[model samples]
Target: MAEGDAGSDQRQNEEIEAMAAIYGEEWCVIDDCAKIFCIRISDDIDDPKWTLCLQVMLPNEYPGTAPPIYQLNAPWLQGQERADLSNSLEEIYIQNIGESILYLWVEKIRDVLIQKSQMTEPGPDVKKKTEEEDIECEDDLILACQPENPVKALDFDVSENRTIEIEELPPIDHGIPITDRRSTFQAHLAPVVCPKQVKMVLAKLYENKKIASATHNIYAYRIYCEDKQTFLQDCEDDGETAAGGRLLHLMEILNVKNVMVVVSRWYGGILLGPDRFKHINNCARNILVEKNYTSSPEESSKTLGKNKKCSWSDGLSENPGVSICSYVLK
Candidate 1:
């Protein structure tokens, strides 16, 4: 590389590093490949529909190959511009680095740049709100995904004849179990409060509380993520179990601290055996970890929390330092 080219390349590397620190693992997907940075400008900024941002990263192959492609979902890139860009990418040969790749790269980049250049501007706070809140921030238009209004999956109800019906779907709830609880030894999780620890925190907080208790053949617990109004059904349990330690062990693996997982086991006529209890608890814990409630709460409280959105690591610099995702479920 020429001296000047080397100097520019080095400069770009340094800048990407800074971004990586700010964005962490997620940064790799958007930051430099050949050292070119594209500023993601969201054209709209008021009440966004989904998270929107400009993604700048060089395609795997470059230079003599195709130039880096622009992931322009900017507020302005919607509508016709979006369609055109979408069509352009459908060209099979243009997918990766290859002969005259730079031409195609620059060509697409040019198209996007021209479109973006003409787009409107977002407010000064767009950057702070979107990345910090994990909400989409736009330059001139708003494209965010608030939990209160998430992008729903296509609405379709199952039928014997199978005719798709598009309409509102009801929230899922397994409902209270119907059975007897006489000899049933009910083990309840105390109300546990954890900042980041997902499993133990919530359950620990609700451990001693008898507020939500019942006797039946079914056992159930909730997984509280950062977002309360979402994925509430991620928790799991069986109506019967002889031992609940397996559930306790699974909690250890997740290092989840804040939210609670309340497992209320009911008595069943026939015992499923002790091994079954371990397996059942294990299953429940896995469901909680998989459900991923840590960030869920943060997301739900996004607009409500005002300005407290932050990564798990951010806690280190602040009052409570980040630690091993530890688990201590009682």
Candidate 2:
């Protein structure tokens, strides 16, 4: 190996060692090849229920001429939130090219997680303390600490905590039934407030005997928490691999919030390969268009089909066997 290449490899190994030490064994996950490193991180240190897993692969010339490739994964992270973090990571690498950037990347992600946590969590006390109030509190503390006279402390009773109940909204099932070959795709849409609601909606859909038998009940959701003022988005591939992520990405691009889209596919015994992804996205997009959730007046008027029959010939070959027929549920 050339001297320059050898030096680059040594530096990369040193950086990896430093990362392992800083993150510890439990938090850091390294692949067998030692080329890929992943760290499990959380927005809140106190609670790690929701976490972001960051993984990076160092190329042969890393920190010398090539940049490390990285990906961020989280159950409830999608849309602009995911894009922003990715962009920041790339910017960090670009600004500090040919330098040890693993540490900087980790710290930058930590800062973003903290900021996101603060936004999602409740803010601190609204009332501000005046200088006079601070002085009074200090004097009280000093008086209480004196040994000459016993401080008379007030006893307070513990109050019972009351739980506030949230009403459950019924799931909305709307879709455009599309068929390609022997496969059938029925897309369903519903408004969801929290992750729990997303689960509930999926459960309700699975309850239907017709939907339960489908080979893949792929789904994606984008919800906005009014209380936290933060966006929550997620996707599940079911048995369709990356189909769920693609659907979720489409929803994010459309700026759809507080909505979940599920595409149930009854496999026709034929493997569609990449074509399945196209069909899945089209099914979900048709529902969004019909509900007017992602369409503007001008765009809708121009794009809306006259006979309610949407065709894919514009993008596909002349003999594409797919057909999308939309239906809006009252």
Off by over 4 Å in 2: 1-167, 226-229, 295-330
Best by TM-score: 2
Task: Write candidate 1's Cα lDDT for 146-243 as tens digits.
Answer: 22332222222222242223212212111121122222232223222232223322222223233124332223222334564221222333343322
Q: lDDT tens digits, residues 52-152, model 2?
A: 67788877878776677677766666898877777776665555555556666666677777777677754332222233311111121111111233222
Candidate 1 — which residues are off by over 4 angstroms? 1-244, 293-330
Question: Which candidate tops lDDT?
Answer: 2
**Judged by lDDT against the true structure, how good is candidate 2?**
0.60
Residue 206, model 2: lDDT of 59
lDDT (CA) per prediction: 0.33, 0.60
Candidate 1, number of clashes: 61
TM-score of each model, paired residue for residue? 0.21, 0.41
